[model samples]
Target: MENLDIAKFGGTSVGNFDAMTSSYKVVVGNKNSRIVVISACSGVTNLLVELASGKCSDSKINEIIEKLRDIHEQIIIHLENQHELRNYIEGHLKEIKEQTLLANKGTNDQLTDSIVSHGELMSSYLFVALFKHYGTDAQWFDVRSVMRTDSKFSCAKPICEEIKVLAHDKLLPLINDKTIIITQGFIGSNTLGETTTLGRGGSDYTAALLGEALGVATISIWTDVAGVFTTDPRVVKTAKPIPELTYIEAAEMANFGAKVLHPSTMIPAVRQEIPIFVGSSKEPEKGGTWVRPVTKSEPNFRALALRKNQTLIVLSSPVMVGATGFLANVFSVFAKYNHSIDLVSTSEISIAVTIDAGTTTSGKAEISENMLNELRQFCHVKVETGLPLIAIIGNRMSENSGVITKAFDAINKFSVRMICYGASRHNLCFLLKDGDTTEALNELHKQLLED
Candidate 1:
């Protein structure tokens, strides 16, 4: 198969019949052999989360069920001759409903993954049947069969080598034989053959992994938006679409709160030098952001990423100005608690770090109690919440003259809590009061970007 590209449609992209129609056009218009990945219809995953979390008990479960039925029956009524598929979806929903009636059990992550997986599973099945109805030669695949992961039910990391072999053995032949091969994103199976889900915004990760396994050079992420922007459009109205970015730039933007793509989504792609294209399912003519290994032109500063709900943890210890294992000790607690932190500014006497307190997922707490207690053993710890971390992202930022003064000038009006610069090649980060995040972004966009 020549020119095989992976195209993944997001939840809203496959959310309804109209959305599916647009996506079908995109899938069918392509000249190359393509693999199609779809997420659950919009809102389905959240409902599943409620059910799986036991947030909706027996008394309240019926409400979520009615909503699910309304959403699916709307589509099912139109997917002619797929009674088998409809029954399959209905069965899964019924199981979810029944499971909710019982006390929610097992690893919370595992239960949530299993229940929420219905989103992708149902979406892919309905989509494949639609493609067939419209005379497209599409074959549906259960991604769990091929995409292998650990037993870590939520946030399951793909075992690349194992997944590569499994995908090659199972998916390659299907792609080779058909013009279109359809599968779900954000869901995989463990070695135990139990259902598992990747973290939030994981559909992108699934698409890229499959593309890498098949040796495709690029993967297209089809979503509701047209492209990645210079900054979040909601924050800065003048934020325009960036035509292209290197993997580092995109990864930095993702890490700094570019919601278009997941931060870890690029790891596998970067390893194989597989590029990514982010585009809209509805409006394909506008083009989109292209992320690859190299770029024709480089900008001094490309974009700004703002992450809110941050907690700044400051640790001051007088063990000595020079301490042997302080760095290791502080980081060890992070690992022990499975805490994912963002930025760090260190001094001889203290360490300042920022993490997303909003990292709480469907049914999990962000801060770990044991980790916090351990950290207080040796250091005076002060935690401040309600701060937003704004990252100014670029390439070769160290060499960009005046970029620092200019950024600082833009946010000078805001109460700046911390600034971490010259530490990372891709971004210069600033901590700001939550109230000042928007004001800072607006000023920076005006001062630093071209309208």
Candidate 2:
């Protein structure tokens, strides 16, 4: 007998009542013993964040509340058996309103988790009701009882061992009953029993985590896009979808800039060597991208992704002539701030590192001024902004000679400042002016994939 599969849907896929109904049809059509994970409704998280931060006026909060009520109400009306489901949705909305008022008195961070969690909570509740209305045997399960993490409000780390044990003990019985379990994702409880979130767009990670624990055959992420593309279609005119990718290739693409999949979402799936499929909610027959272990075929091009608003910081220390521990001390400051270093190149006199610029509303680098001031302790530090990093990833690149040389030669006309190839040879990244990111991606795509 085939093992059960796990299907996870993102925000846009379940943005409203109609989309939710469409997603339910897709899941039912699969007909596998499965667990479904859902994210918050489209704009609910942002609205809740605004309300929690006191940025939203009373009118705005009320407006959001009414709008959310209408969305659920519409779903209730469309449901075949509307009486019980309508009552259930109405009751859940009342509970959410009361909880919102109670949470407003807490700290912003705690309130943020509380309010943002409502998105998943409300969506999952309605989903279970809709499933039952459609004559599917379904039940709602609160993920917090199974997924345990620390008290970190926004970015809680999953305690895998504890989660595995609890999930089998608690959720397996529900699965054995042949029930399709609907659960809220991106929200979990700490050892202290306080609600915590796994950061933005973390529902994907939740699905993968559950799949890993259950040792499921496959995890499907149903989203708005067809699949992972060579470049963001909005940015590149002729962007193409990558049919397949290795785990390392997918991780690099996600880390660099692919918005379809979260970087952390792959950890659990990879740990268990479970295959992941990224498909479309709108067009399920299109056959979206698949990610798994490396294959034997030599793929010409895996994918291209870009990270913009990068600040290149160059540190030149003439004071110490080859002093030991100087680099260590310099790096410790970044570690203290929990800042991530993306690209690095060092010489005897100078060290250059590229970091995300923390862009502003105008899309200009906001970190250039602040980072320049911090680098004053060193003999000389220069900050350059308006740069972007382009990542080209493929497992076959490890054995393929001249891949980097060919790629660099293709983009040689661009004002590239830095190039860093990973030691594993799975990724080749280059830095160029933000203006050239699109053109470079287009040229590389044509040369590698399209041509």
CA lDDT of each prediction against the hidden true structure = 0.82, 0.77
Model 2 lDDT tens row, 1-451: 1667888999888887778887998898886737999988777676666656544555766787787777767666766767776666567556656556665554345556776787788888878877887788888999999989887667678999989999999987788435789998888989888988887778888998889888899999999888888788888878887788788888888878787887787899999999999989878888899998875554646778888878888889885576888788777767665556778887788888888643111122334344455666665877787688888876556576877677777777888788887665667788886675777888877776676
Q: Write the per-residue lDDT of candidate 1 for residues 37-74, one digit (tens) a residue.
A: 88889999888778877656566788888888777777
Backbone clash pairs for candidate 1 read none
TM-score: which candidate is best? 1
Pairs with backbone N, CA or C atoms under 3 Å apart (clashes), candidate 2: none
RMSD of 2: 3.9
Q: Report how far residue 159 has shifted in candidate 2, in Å.
A: 0.8
Off by over 4 Å in 1: 102-107, 177-179, 357-365
Model 1: per-residue Cα lDDT at residue 82: 60
